[model samples]
Target: MTSILIADPIPLLNKGEQALLEGIVESLNIIFSKPDIMLLSNYPEKDARRSRIPVINRNPVLFKSIKKIMPRSAFLLEGALMAILARFGKQNFRRLFTRSELWQAFLNSDIIVVGHDSSVSYDAVIIGWLLNKPLVIFAGSIELFRNKLKESIAKVLLKKVNLITLREDDSYKALMDLGVIPGVKTQVTADAAFLLKPCSPERVKEITQQEDLPVHDRPKVGVTLTRQMCERSHQEINDVNERYKKAIAEKAIVLDEIIERYNVEIVFFPHCIGPGKNDDRLVARDVIQLMKRKDMVKPVVSDLGASELKGLIGQQCEVFIGERTHSVIAAMSQGIPSICITFPSDRRTHGIIGGMICQRDFIYNVERLNPIELLTLVDKLWAERPVIRKKLEGIIPLVKERALNSARLIQTIVSEKEKSDNGYRCPSSQH
Candidate 1:
């Protein structure tokens, strides 16, 4: 069994994260005939198990204790290794506990497929390089979290990496600024989110009814809370509310206006939920209070799983207004036009634009947003919905195309390791 190890965000996390996880997992299982080990982190064995394919769920203890540790990646890897060791009878030593032990895990594997929507650990990248294995990063604006120092580290990691496959042109440029070299091997692919198909009418109807969503022929709008901020713990709710007050207030007004002008119906989608947090409810409550129309609908309050949530979004909206990139992704996948009201630090708007997407896809700096400008864009997007949908149809096919190409990059890197393990080529070293 040419074992390939997958490092991805698991579905139990949130809808956007789940969508990425589901898409990546299904792709690997279908594309690779070989039996593999998927090192599942942050989720339990039962939670990570699949239906048909056999996969080993390596339990880790350290990850459970990974709470705001300094040098986050080191802590993440340490936590994972400790957790894995605890599953056995062994105690984790501080030092094969060395990088060498981690290298062996990578070298023994035929390939390593990193996240399409996952947070790639520094350990994963470093060890993959040490093993001289093929390293491929599948994602959108994967650099969103990295700063200058981290970007330097990423450049070094890219040295032995086979490819850094980004779904957005702007992200590719972001990588270049960080030192990713330009070449045929450095791929700019479309987001895998587009590969998710629309739900069957029965399935859609089921979820729509289950969520208490409106299903009439009236024009509807989708509203997905920010996936990252949405899934934080209950303790974080007050913090988000205080921090993002202006943006939320601005958005509430936009929704109210759209409801008045277009008679908008909404599927109030929540992307993530931690132990006791309900961000969507908070958002939904705020929006409801702000609205002038009771006819503007909202989905019922309950934790909808990732698949069901996507189905609900797919069926309910003609367009979406979201804070999360993946929420916009859900809207995009369905050929439903969306506008991302982004945070100050987010570069996703630029990335989507690089793919030839227009400004209608996203707007940046919502924290200091001009209400008039935002409302104007909303009205304009509403007016040109059909034209935008037509363009998205052409864009949708690129999702799978990019994924397949990304898979090929990993295949080439893994194949080369069989010939020599002296050193691997850096992505920067390519043409």
Candidate 2:
């Protein structure tokens, strides 16, 4: 059996990452002939073929404790906002985030697959380069888009790697222009997480049972928000807030109206529950409070497990407006159409829009947002979805195909790594 390793820095995953990782591990397990897969994550689970190998960390109990603290996570997320503020103020608050064991785990892996934007992969990429491991990456806005410096590092990292599994043709071509060679050796694969299986209707009914109300009776709506644009200078913030404030205001306005107009019950879901200003829980809290009535709306605040969240998304919710990339992905996989909101530079917008393949228009760009226009588009989409959904059924297979291609890449990587270990010639460095 070919052995492979998964390096995820954020040990305690928020819903989307967990679902993505699960699909990757399970698909590879089968395709690679039930390979012995070792995963080094902060939160490990016990499963059959895959072993959640624990890394050396002092006080696992404390780490677990820190993970469950929702408010604290929001506050810590604020530190990222602070850290960004510090970039301007020159404060350097990032030294607190380094985990020595994360890299140590990377050193032990045959291939290291990392999502973008985590401080863990920030170092993991370098470690892979230093160790000469086949470094495979699937990055875009969901992991936060790269800035100039990150782009620079990503360039070097992409070059140093044995293979580059890009998420989109745009990103793939960008790399190719910067000297990435494409062939069977270096392929453009889908976001491996897109292979996620939707929750069955029965499974969906089971998870929401704890919520009590009959599936049809509950007015279920999914809401997600990210405050990255808000952490900027007041002028920049105001510009974005003005553009999006109306959209947020409109979403609130429309949602408030939807609650009244449709007698719908809205459920706010915090996609990224990390520290301070970036804390989605706080943003959800802010939005919930901003809306008039607490009785008509609810926030599922438990930091749910992946399966639980996926089932929730699949449940016959009237609508799910995705504020995060994975939220849209989860919704689409479940045959639920979503209105995706993104910042100007969000790579995820392109990723999901591409996934939609013009089958169903489910994207809303937040930078140049016009709430009234967006609301108009939402109206048309809402009215047209029955027809739109049929279109989705046709394209779902294409999206699913891309996801399987990602698994193909992982299997190929594992095979190539095995060949290297057996002292075969290195897979001709086509990339």
Q: How well is each residue in 1-431 modelled by candidate 2, as lDDT tens digits?
A: 44355654434445566566666665665566756555554434422112233333221232344546653353233323332332333323322222233333433456666543222244445544444567665432223334877666655655665555555566555655555454324655565556656556676666556654344575576767767533321344556556445444545666676676557687776666654455677766766666776677767666555556666766746667766777777766666667877665555456556543563356765655554666676676677767766766777677767666656776677777666652111122111
Question: lDDT of each structure?
Answer: 0.59, 0.55
**Runs off by more than 4 Å, candidate 2:** 41-108, 114-122, 129-132, 138-153, 182-184, 198-209, 212-219, 229-250, 420-431
Question: By how many angstroms RMSD does model 1 differ from the true structure?
Answer: 7.2
Clashes of each: 8, 13
Q: Per-residue lDDT of 1-431 in model 1, one digit per residue for the tens?
A: 55666544354545566566556555555565654655544454534432123333333323344434544455346534533432332433422333333323443556666545535555666555444456667654565544777767766766555667776676666666666666425777656555554457787787666766775788888876543433232233467555455455555676777788887676677776553453566667665666666567674577655566677777677888777676677777667888876654455544653343554445645544666787888887888889889987877666566655655555566567666654322222222
Model 2 vs. true fold: TM: 0.73
Per-residue lDDT for 5 in model 2?
52
Question: Highest TM-score among the candidates is held by which one?
Answer: 1
How big is the positional error of residue 329 in model 2, measured in Å on the Cα after superposition? 1.0
